[model samples]
Target: MKHIFKFLGIATLACLTWSCADIDKDEVGDESKLPNAVYIEGADVNPVTKLTVDAAGGKSSFTARAANKLGSNVTLKFAINEKALEKYNELNGTHYKLLPAKYYSLSAENLTISANNISNGSIDVNVKPLDNELDASTKYAIPVSIASAEGGSLLNSSVTKIFAIDRVLYTSSLRQNGFYLKTTFNPPYTNLQEWTLSYAIKLDQNKDNQAVLSPDFYSRVTADGGLQMKVGETDDPKAFAKTKLQPGKWYYIAWVYNRQHVKCYINGTLDTEFDVPKVETFTKLNMSWGAFVGYVREIRLYDKALSAFQVMDNLYIETPENPNLLFYAPLDKNTGIKDVSKNHHAIKVYTAGSDDATEYNQSLITWQDEKFPE
Candidate 1:
């Protein structure tokens, strides 16, 4: 009876050992098989992709790929995920608005990975051009996600991709043919005790001794070869310097004024400063006197006086979007000018040789490539 019981116990132990070995073998075999997951190629480096494009023409694209080699073909489905965009916006404290799905389309909304080319297959995501009226500062985004995968699993870590779009700021060159753009001063300069006005200009030497910027009450520059500022309706304009500017050469001009004093800077160097009694208001800004011809780039107005360092730092920036900036005219469009400031001021253009003789004449205005005078 003892021998029979031992034999039965040994047989049961052998059977249990064989069952455990088989389970281990199955686990190893499964692990050896390549994982079947769809993911974006270079997701780590291109997690958040960005593209800058002109409003009128062009498209941007990126590729989505699958991981591992499979025995059969697999089809992956993609979709725009608004929820992913919302989450990203929340985390970044940004107002990156969503673009319409129509603006973007995949090479194949349903991408197929052939059995032979499983690891090498990919889908192309193309973004179409947007309207010119859209603000460049306001970023747009399209979040694309792998909605589903047939014969494969979607990679949880890299299932979604964020595509950001930024519009290129427009810039156009204008001739001195009495072409000038004007926009209202918001928070109006009427009550302000301090302010700064700055612009990039390249003057035609032939048009010397003409007013570069004029207000009904004052002129910022005169052909006399210096920065001039008039107090009230007074003819005795304060001259920054009698420095003759080279024609066809780019120059940065900045005027800072407070109740106590006014300072003028040329190319970031303080050229002149003078004491002045408190003034009431500055009404307008005029770019040229019909005969004055040159190029104008970024024109900015600040509510507060900017320091020399600030002026120098801002010289390199083609677009000045400062918070204190009350008015901005990039002068980038070929026909109609735009004010890219918070005020959304009205812009008026005056063209030379117009029969209408109106301040705003679209007929006579012409634009070319904005080239700063070297």
Candidate 2:
């Protein structure tokens, strides 16, 4: 909800310095008149912000700023306004539980807004909800307020910055059993001359041409065993990455097809690249048969070939807003086949005895306790 900040606090101080006066009811907003008015910079834009914080615990920051130049140094005091959460849940039509005080910390409750130089300072909020006793399934909220500015006024309207947080712990990997994930490719993507496909995996064992990228592993061989990427029509001249993958370890694999060069990346480093005859192939990714065993996460498909730096950077992120991205999935077992991509698709999860893609069955998928390594 958008609200114009109306500050009226420390009436004695306000009367002595500059009496708190709100903007006109018709909204003739003039910040020059109230030079000492204070408001949180990030919260000023949107008082309530939603965040999906890692259950491992981390810090969230916000900047305390003034509506205008501070005549003198202003000491802004922040407080954990627990009462605000009540009104927040009432308005949003949500039954979010109040985040326990022990789960979070306002490390920077007092910030100094220097009149000479810096007009703002950071407010660090450290949260570790899962560290204590709590329901992982329930949603929580933390409301932090600019309680009182020693040299500035406090706004009753935009006092608190509410954080609607959902603590999510992703599954380490989803074992690709008998099922395979498939999506109908658009004309532009399948026909692209250059493309990049990346994902994380852990191999259980290896067989000759074990299904990795596609069900139809093509007529290519990298000696005894390894993963494969399709590059041409059935039985046509093919390209192979030929990287030696060890079993029982996690790997961030990237298959980049840049014109005549086919590159394969392992754990963000170039494992192998070979010059191949000009060839094109259809989209076949994350294909797993009953015989082949492994796990996968963050499977992404891009239209253009990605650089080494881009591949390395891609390892740490999920569902990035890239125009070249055709499809992406963090493979969070909780989400269950939901693609968090530019063109997101609720791809069907094919099980052993289930032929229908439309029929969704959560019990068929198993979620591992471990999560992606950094």
Candidate 3:
């Protein structure tokens, strides 16, 4: 299971104003003509990392930024070549594909465009693509041009000179039992209002079980004891009640808990919500899919609690061939799919050693906050 985790808010807006005044200038005299006069001095699009989905259900992201400077807010449209996406969908009429979970620095070859009468501009960017087994081959490039609203003619174009994505590889051997990920800090500070956990579970009373990304223990306000495993416990909220589970079968589970609220997603369905108190701290966090059938794959943990929509976005049934089991093997980490330990740390991971006892991974990921520490 891969446990995972941005910026650009009010401060960025203020900075935009100070650096680019033309963006806020008055529009053309006529509203209809406003688009015609609209010359995007600067535009960019970036995919949110970790959350980006690809063909194999990995992470991929694209980020775009544009400044109209034309006075009125005209839709700045972005078009991807038809071949750019896989597993495409049509929700209503708009079409989008699930981005791969890896990092990819798009290059000029990966993109195609035609533009009109504007020229003399440049594009600056930093990108990381999904696969880069080699250096010097290049993973990203900037495509900048001056043209009409419809990319018709190109006055000038420039490609990024040197693009590199910081490569990060998370180990897969850490998923086995006694394996826990812990950050700096103790209990009471591990409670985070924006943390989300999602994974698959299959418990086997007969054999060694596998649990994807189960929270060993959680304090649920609705639970009789105020704490319980995410499911299969009577004390848990009705949503988490473990009624009957079959062995050798996979059941999807998602839990979003925080100071602000709490909810659960079972088998891809937003089943229930309960008014739960914020949990500051507790210990002995252990999770296995269904009553000890501790088998798991593709586990993810987010620093911020996710909304229903975001939780749905996090679901990806596909996985890499011969995927790693323990540590995180991010397709790309340079873009921003990184550790959530900005402040606190509570994930402690242990692995089965040669002696059969558990061996610590040595690397301790600090909690972005200190609500719960091991």
TM-score of each: 0.49, 0.50, 0.38
The per-residue C-alpha lDDT of model 1 at residue 60 equals: 51
Residues 1-374, candidate 1, lDDT per residue (tens digit)? Answer: 23333544665575576775664454532423435566766664556676544545335554556554666777877888889888876665445678766676777677777774545445555667776555544567778888887877666667778776645544465555666555445445776678887877777664435566664334444555565666555555454544557677777888787775878888878888886656546566666646567767667777778777567545523333446777777665543466677765777776654532567556566666643222
Q: Which window of ten consecutive residues has the lowest lDDT sum in model 1?
A: 26-35
Who wins the TM-score comparison?
A: 2
List, residue by residue over 149-195, the lDDT tens digit for candidate 2. 88667556666788766455445467777666666554424446787
Tell me the lDDT of candidate 1.
0.63
Taking every candidate in turn, the Cα RMSD to the unseen true structure, in Å, is 15.5, 13.2, 15.4
Error of 2 at 173 (Å): 2.0
- The local distance difference test score of each candidate is 0.63, 0.63, 0.34
* Clash count, candidate 2: 2
TM-score for candidate 3, please give it. Answer: 0.38
Per-residue error for 110 in candidate 3, Å, reads 16
Position 145, candidate 2: lDDT: 88
Clashing residue pairs in candidate 2 are 172-370, 172-371
Off by over 4 Å in 3: 1-147, 150-191, 205-237, 241-246, 267-269, 282-284, 288-291, 298-301, 316-374
